[model samples]
Target: MGRYRETYERWKASPEAFWAEAAREIDWSKPWDRVLTLEGDLSRWFEGATCNTCWNALDRHVEGGRGEQLALIHDSAMTGKVKRFTYRELRDKVATFAGVLQRHGIGKGDRVILYMPMVPQAVVAMLACARLGAIHSVVFGGFAAKELATRIDDARPKLIVSASCGLEPGRAIAYKPLLDQAIELSEHKPEACIIVQRAELEAPLVPGRDFDWKDEMEKARAAGAAPACVPVAATDPLYVLYTSGTTGKPKGVVRDNGGHMVALKWSMKNVYGVDPGDVFWAASDVGWVVGHSYIVYGPLLHGCTTILFEGKPVGTPDAGTYWRVIADHGVKALFTAPTAFRAIKKEDPAAELVKKYDLSKFELLFLAGERGDPDTIQWAERALGVPVIDHWWQTESGWPMVANPMGLERLPVKYGSPTVAMPGYEIQVVDEAAKPVPANTTGAIVVKLPLPPGCLPTLWHNDEGFRNSYLADYPGYYKTADAGYLDEDGYLYVMSRTDDIINVAGHRLSTGGMEEVLAGHPDVAECAVIGVADALKGQVPVGFLVVNKGVNRPAEEIAKEAVALVRDKIGPVAAFKTALVVQRLPKTRSGKILRGTMRKIADGEAWSMPATIDDPVILEEIGEALSDAGYGRKG
Candidate 1:
């Protein structure tokens, strides 16, 4: 048997012992009373322990004689600037920042909201919060004021850290206006705001409430202020990440201190196969969970050099920017969303830009945050000539639930699957009645409770909401809300969200399956399939395709071919007939296709503009395309 199966079986035998062994990698101020404990349905790992995440991530490395080693590399393609910080440098910065926050009466358990762009200060602020045992919630930079206000009210931060402006390809988005608006709109007003004034755009600060970030840091440094790391209990709240709830109010997924550090540090070597000192880059924004885990904590805790990239896959100059960053930094592994690769593939179909840089040191490419379509995965594999592993997890999980553990074993690649379940997750596919389904049969995917370490203990301030959201659906399992199945060999194929499964005349079909077929089309760059209301078949699948940049063939012809491909591959049971060629698909800032919104548009149902949409104009374009295809509202 492979090492993966052996390790998984061992973990299954005794989860507490497995986690205890993993805990050894972390530095703790006080040992735990127990490895695991259960209170009703909620499980807590490493209870009664005390540890400071900032100490392990920064100070530990510095004290271990790796002070000169590079800790963070902030590379911004938009600004054409690069900043590097050694372990010692970063540690000192974090310590001083912690002192700054301390001076502002921020301490353990106090909440701080970070509303900054992909800047080095954002990283420092997060570590600073951890150093003081404070809980930090990072709202995505440049979010709509109303959405930011909602989070501000929910998290109720004592202090807010923000940048003056966030840069796009050719423009600068002034965040001060939005931050000011959110604060004005919020009922729970924060005491202070620290605004990072960027060179691109310097925002006017409020007279009393807003303080200049640079001035505060300088004052703290001049005073030789450095705060010592504060020890907190294992189960103390580390961070609260908000994921959109069905009820419109966002759910704050709470991650704990000890378990989070242990799981993420373990994942660095075990999941990505990267050693200490190796440069690892997660091309994601810190506003998202991937950023919170990999870009900041994971790499730092593992003593790997992490990159903070502030650019797009295609427009940050060119599609060659990613290759350039890898070649220049000698990045050993890169973890990014599949949508990024799709964007790159769309612009550079032949992967010609890849040849411009030397990526010999780049060994592994991990894709998450979206279903990694087989076509995109295959294209990435061919382009990068490295293992393109697509892992599966969620904002609540904080770490990967299912992945190909490259460090433990290099398992055989499966095109659509994210390989097998990790040691901690006992994934099972079950039908609506909660009965286990046969292998390869599509159903709701769930994890047998209690969930392992690093996953959300509960939603912040809402234990009942947590139970209702995840646990109530499955009696003894954590409802993943994802629909997929495991193969006979135990490899998981995460096809789509549970709601994405469409029913056609009593037959349930996966829209992700249809999307996979459409993506496989030779000229298609990216695609999305959503089920629209149809009187004839209950619900029929409609596809939207974004063809490759250079493909000049008639859009109608290509759309017809895509429809045929889906009909042939998924069989006529899909009822997949219509495919519209569009310039782009509407996506959130995090690159998730807004299928629900598109479905609403096609069904002629009243739908509000999504707050997280990357561009509002894209939805208008999509609506027009649907109308031309005889789908959307006649008006």
Candidate 2:
């Protein structure tokens, strides 16, 4: 704790100097002339520095005699296969892939789209793009053709990398057809598409435009040609990842090279308490920012073995798989989404699988991607005998903005709080007027400019959109759009997204807070709380709950227990009386609850279906439940 406060104060006093010192840990091609330069909202970090992200992540480690050391441990429960790659092996593959891309005239500064699953080839493809100094725009593999087409039009990529199929728990879903459809629908088409024959589905190649991945790799290897790492400027674009927007369009978040390298390396050591050669696992897809920073770049940059897991928490042969993997690999740290634990808790409440494995090797477990509820945190920490940190960040901020800073010092655990801001990040709770609020008072969360390294510099192709969406919301601060508060101890409690906050009888209430309470109910498996229009109170919370399997209690009785628990825990201000038991809550393919879509259904507003949704039928079921409960809109 003392170390945390000390580092925070030191960073606040001299951020540029602090970051400069941290940057020294990595192998830079050329030293920076200026540590930082700022003009209004725009920032330039490590000015005059030139380096290749691939060189830092791979070549440096291999050149430093760690070539035989394990760099990637790919475990695919979906395919029931495991593969390992050493630093040297991964480098050779990336070099060959880069050569393949170069043969097609794709070079530095060109954009390439990666639409693939959580496979080793996806990792190879991303590293290959970085090796050539090309910017990779990774669209989530589960995205539909229309959504993929939208991103294709925006990026206009020169090349596309995809897989023939993505294996789910019970079925193998073909992806090459989807990619073909997306290419057909988009106005801009790539020069060529490279497809990995994963499931052996017959995917016809369009002459002169489609190429088989294995054939190209073999040819490149036979030719004895390997692409050299192309040096890129510090401020050059490394990747552009899009975020889901309510306006039916996505905002491409751009991350620069140098700052991203430095910040992520620092975070891997200081925030996650991981060192070189350790096994670190972040159970996220390659498309997300967490995957970009931790699973791929950060750990590799720090010379650690990163795991690429392709499995769910409960489905891939029960809840014991994670424990088995940790035990088998001696994984030092595990980072995953809180929703995963919630689902695991529902499937195996006692966590019997935890005792089956020798998890003594695990040092820490991290939770993110959604709000970490108290029940989920306590369950994981107590079961795993490790610190379960509830860190907070978003797509725009590549690394965590608020975390426990485990490498610095382990502090007293606050169940729901994500703890203090990391070095270079100054967070504050402010009211609608953009003025600072008192401690323990909920308000919009904002970070004082300029943001730390690893944060998005701007939205791709839309500078004004970046300013209007994030910067202009509150002058002088980067509006987080999420609502939270700081305690007297400086621990931050992120309650909900500002739009998800409910106003009941003129008092603001956090639906996430209410959902946390509902989660503690004995008969509840999972639940989502959403604010629906109330003619009198402006808005009120309506809960959609999934009752725990094998619970003997009636659905109505379980709902009553949930309401009582919330009423007692949150007091009368919560106004959380109504709840309905549903079979399943609408969720994205990544398992995020679709609260916004639920709110639209409750309010009877015109809604566009999100391509990321797992099941469209769940929305209809919710509507039926709402109508039966008399909260449905009049048709």
Q: Against the true structure, whose lDDT is highest?
A: 1
Best by TM-score: 1
Q: Compute the lDDT of residue 67 as modeled in candidate 2.
A: 98
- Candidate 1 off by > 4 Å: 245-247
The digit string of per-residue lDDT tens for model 2 on 488-538 reads: 999999999999988898999898889889888877778899999989889
TM-score for each of the candidates: 0.99, 0.98
TM-score of candidate 1 versus the correct structure, residues matched by position: 0.99
- Compose the digit string of candidate 1's lDDT tens values, residues 175-202: 9999999999999999999999999999
RMSD of each: 0.9, 1.3
Q: Which ten contiguous residues of candidate 1 have the minimum total lDDT? A: 241-250
TM-score, candidate 2, is 0.98
lDDT of 1: 0.94
